[model samples]
Target: MNLFKYWKKDVPASLVVFFVALPLCLGIALASGAPLFSGVIAGIIGGVVVGLISKSNIGVSGPAAGLTAIVLTAITDLGGYEIFLVSVVMAGILQIIMGLLKAGVIGYYFPSSVIKGMLCAIGIIILLKQIPLVLGLSGEMESDRITFINFHEKISIGVIIVSVVSLLVLLLWDEVLAKRSNLFKLVPGPLIAVAIGIIIYLTMGQSGDLALNQSQLVNVPIPEDFNSFISNFTFPNFSALNNPAVYLTALTIAVVASLETLLSVEATDKLDPMKRQTPTSFELIAQGIGNTLSGLIGGLPLTQVIVRSSANVMSGGLSKLSTVLHGLLLLLSVIIIPKLLNLIPLAVLASVLLIIGYKLANPKRFVEMYKLGKEQFIPFIVTVVAIVIFDLLVGIIAGLIVGVIVLLLKSYTNSHSMLIKEFEGKKNLYHMNLAEEVTFVNRGSIVKELDALPQGAFLELDFRKTKILDYDILEYLDEFKVKAKNNNIQIKIISERGIVDDPHSFREFFGHKVFKMGH
Candidate 1:
């Protein structure tokens, strides 16, 4: 494919993603309790470095909200931001090792139910986190700390009015204008909302009551000179490398960041219109390099983020160049016109995030999961609730545990089928057909079926269609064979290999060589 053939499309798409990414970078950093510039630095590296290295045509990378809790805690536990950067570097090295080991297959083990739950949970989190900002509340206060009484007291009328208008403009652009005109398609709703916010900031400035204070607006730090801008970049404290806690923190970050990146890759590929597949292992390596560079330069750990990736896809991005362009835009904006960017209201950015969150946590998704059955819906709901109550890692683990139980229950309940046949001038014949997958969970069901067999009967145990027969099931069958002989029941085992007349060879008949050898 000619990568530049879609430049016309990709350029506009990049612009849209840039607008979507800007506030997120700042918000995540604020949430992470790190320097705001670190987030932007990660965004730049994720875009230019990972984007160029990654094979994913549509996937976008940046500072992940999923890592915010981890970073916040690590910074405190590690003693300082510089020390935490050391952990990030070590994490990058670990990610590179994992990639080289081809451990990306772990992504496939995550159930779809859990992944959907994760998405929904993140959506709920984004909504809850942005509510205060949307209502004009500022600072690094936690969402739980903002009570209705305090929220009402702190609400700024000007910010509220601007936010409402910005949200409405976003809806109009997406729901109406984009559908009506091609010009509107080139310009994204987020960009329009931001522009309207800036206009309102200027329009309301003349009236003291309507004007928004500095706290209500975007806080892009304005550097005094070239030296000041250069000074903002921080280097990791290498002395922390000897600390055992640093290694532990690094391992945690590596595992969590890798999982998040792989998850986002899966989500983005599903959203791709062309259905292009991403090389998961290669993507990990790219992310590893990006994180390593980011950590060295005092940036947040980066990952393939679904929110930004989905935005890129929805906005018509067709290649990695769009992602790269967005990074360049972020770099230039911070350096050249940060003051102008600061004019945009935080409320407007919060409105943009609210829309994205609503899309992710749409009620229809829950309805769809419910229609899929309890096997899917239960895990999905559990994941959402768990994430809302706890952190991302805890919520995912809870959902995964629930999903595994459902799988085991299904395996237990549907292990085998039994049939009885009668022939002329012959004793009754019983046939048992094992399910395609017979695990330890199905051992009890199989045993019950075996115990119900009648005496002086001819039995045919069929394993022709069975793919996996557990060791416990084989052992139970071995014991049953001895009892069958005492009951004067003739047993014949049919399998893919052949019929086995000897009971000791039953495990071999089903391809369990290790079990046969032990016997």
Candidate 2:
């Protein structure tokens, strides 16, 4: 990393990613029923700490929305926020152990179809999640702050206008303006949208119902002094280490966090224009360190988030510097200019996410997948549907199961290929060729082909390329001999061993114990 070479690109990309990350951190914390500030802490640690150590060039880490349910349940069951932090710390330790054990190989097993499906599913989720926000369904009035925004009575007219126009800005930048000049390329669309949003808030938000509500703006906690800032973070209950529930929750968080991280790493690699592969094991250690630090300081457990990574890629972030810079920006924003940051509208950020979402789930990608045929398309579509209906982990497992079944079906059909020859002066002759390996699972396929043979036909069974022949297949061949004789069919068998006069001679030719051996 010239580290210095990409400052021009990374700076703008970092700003865009920072804005994208802020709401996510807050929202995920809210969903988890934890202090909203904890999400922000995790975001900062994930970016600055994990980003510093991770081998992945473009991946960005944060508190994942996927882990919200687990966090919520664990927090409730474990007694309180302080108790939950113990589990988070223990989870980080387990993750580090996994990394040392080289368990990262599992990341490679996911097929491209499933990976693409996950990316698209996440994109769709982003688009859907932002709809209400984009419409400015804010909650807080003048007096107090609200945890979650609701889509109740009325939508904001100002919010709608700002979202629409900001979305248009994003669209025009990507599809048209960015290509025309270096200036447009230098200024990220999200940053421009934010600036415009701030202007709108200042100009139209002095005093009226049309003003953006407190919930509609960024709401980071502002501390007056160092001691007060330190007081904002909650510490873990060390005594909870004795509880078995703590270990169980730790196991859950470690497993979920590791898996989500690997998935995001794979997806990020696919999205990278440079196509850099992250060292999965090393990445795990990085995440473990970040989580441990986050837990110690009373923050939510974190994972590599695909949405932020995709935003980084979309914004032209060229190095890990972008990841680090985004983290630094997050830290500075809450302390340095919390008031100024609050002026930024959530609707503009929603518009930014909506554009990134559309690009990920573009219709053209679906057409491309379909063109690859059903083997690829089926799992791709299934993963998308599963993720949309359920959650990330379930969707991936569903897709993996479907992918394997499709593979098995292909293997079954591909057991053998046949060629038929019939001439005016000769008998109808059929040649059946076997693949390199045949197993019991191919029984139905072979039976179907054998039963299709016509009466009085001369049949040639070729197994020269075969390396392994299962005993069940030999038994099936012996059974076929009886039918061949009944139909008055002449049969010849060929293999590396030699051509056999009797198909049933296989019993004597290949000993029972030798059936499993490869030629």
The numbered model that scores best in TM-score is: 2
How well does candidate 2 match the true structure in TM-score terms? 0.92
Runs with alpha carbons beyond 4 Å of true place in candidate 2: 138-152, 422-428, 452-458, 468-472, 478-491, 503-519
Residue lDDT tens for model 1, 1-519: 566878877887788778778877886888789999998999999999999888999999999877888899999999999999999999999999999999888887888898888887777776776777777765432221112224545667888898899889989988999899989878778877888899998998845877888877777768889999988898999998889999999999999999989988877787789999898888888899999999999999999998788778877898988999999999999999899998988788778767877877889999999999999999999999998888676888999999999988888889988888986544578888988877779998888888888888888888888777778788778788899888888888887667865457566555563222222
Whole-structure CA lDDT of model 2: 0.87
Tell me the spans in candidate 1 whose CA falls farther than 4 Å from its real position: 1-3, 138-152, 206-208, 420-429, 454-458, 485-519
Clash number by candidate, in order:
0, 0
lDDT of all predictions: 0.83, 0.87
Candidate 1 TM-score versus the reference:
0.89
Top lDDT prediction, candidate number: 2
* Candidate 1 clashing pairs, residues 3+ apart or interchain: none
Clashing pairs in 2: none
Question: TM-score for all predictions?
Answer: 0.89, 0.92
**Residue 116 CA displacement from its true place in model 1, Å:** 2.4
